[model samples]
Target: MRLSAKRHFGIALVVAGALMCLAGAALYVMPGPGFPVLALGLAAVVIGLLLLAALRRE
Candidate 1:
């Protein structure tokens, strides 16, 4: 079945969040700040919730 634009966007956000988390995890073995990337991924998830709410209002 086909998904709506909002649904697709939400899925994309989820994928992005996952990728961010993976990158952050990888960073732990590297040299940068892993915690901040992990926090940003969590923030992206929060933004996804907001996006859903806004979509509902439309």
Candidate 2:
């Protein structure tokens, strides 16, 4: 079945968030400040999950 556009966007956000988290980890290993990126990634993941959940209810 074809997924809705909103669902696709949500999934993209989750994937992007995961990548951001990985980048943040690399930054930490390189002696840079990574907390902000990590926090933003976590937030994006949470928002994406919430969006998915909300769409599922419809």
Candidate 3:
């Protein structure tokens, strides 16, 4: 079956969030990449949340 946009978006959000959590833990060892990873993950989560909200109304 084909995946809906919401599903894909949600998946991305969760994956990104997971990555962010992981990166946060890694910050103690590597601050350079972890900070950027966290930012990207947060952005993904925000975008996904917006997409999910939009989907709900449609």
Candidate 4:
């Protein structure tokens, strides 16, 4: 099946968010600020999920 651009973008957001969360976790173990990154990542993931769900419903 072929995926549309919107789907690709949504997937990209999810993946990028996951990577950001991972980086944030790693930072938390080190000596940097991690909360902001983690929050942004969570937001990105949520937005992506919502977008995907909305698209699926259409």
Point to the candidate with the largest lDDT: 4
List pairs with backbone clashes in candidate 1: none
Candidate 3 global TM-score: 0.61
Tell me which residue pairs clash in candidate 3: none
User: Model 2, range 1-58, lDDT digits (tens) per residue?
Assistant: 3459899999989998988888887887888998788888888988999989988998
Candidates ranked by TM-score, best first?
4, 2, 1, 3
TM for every model, in the order presented, reads 0.64, 0.86, 0.61, 0.89
Residues 9-44 of candidate 1 have per-residue lDDT tens digits of: 876787788788889888967998998898788777
| Clash count list over all predictions | 0, 0, 0, 0
What are the RMSD figures for all models against the true structure? 3.9, 2.8, 3.2, 2.8
Q: Which stretches of model 4 miss by more than 4 angstroms?
A: 1-3
TM-score of 1: 0.64
Runs of candidate 1 exceeding 4 Å displacement: 1-3, 49-58
Best by TM-score: 4
Once fitted onto the true fold, the runs of candidate 3 whose alpha carbons sit more than 4 angstroms away are 1-3, 28-32
Candidate 1 global CA lDDT score? 0.77
- Model 1: lowest-lDDT 10 consecutive positions: 1-10
What does the lDDT come to for candidate 4? 0.88
- Give me the displacement of residue 52 in model 3, in angstroms: 0.5
Candidate 3 clash total? 0
Predicted candidate 3 versus true structure: per-residue lDDT over 1-58, tens digit per residue: 2348667867788777777867765883675556767666677777777777766686
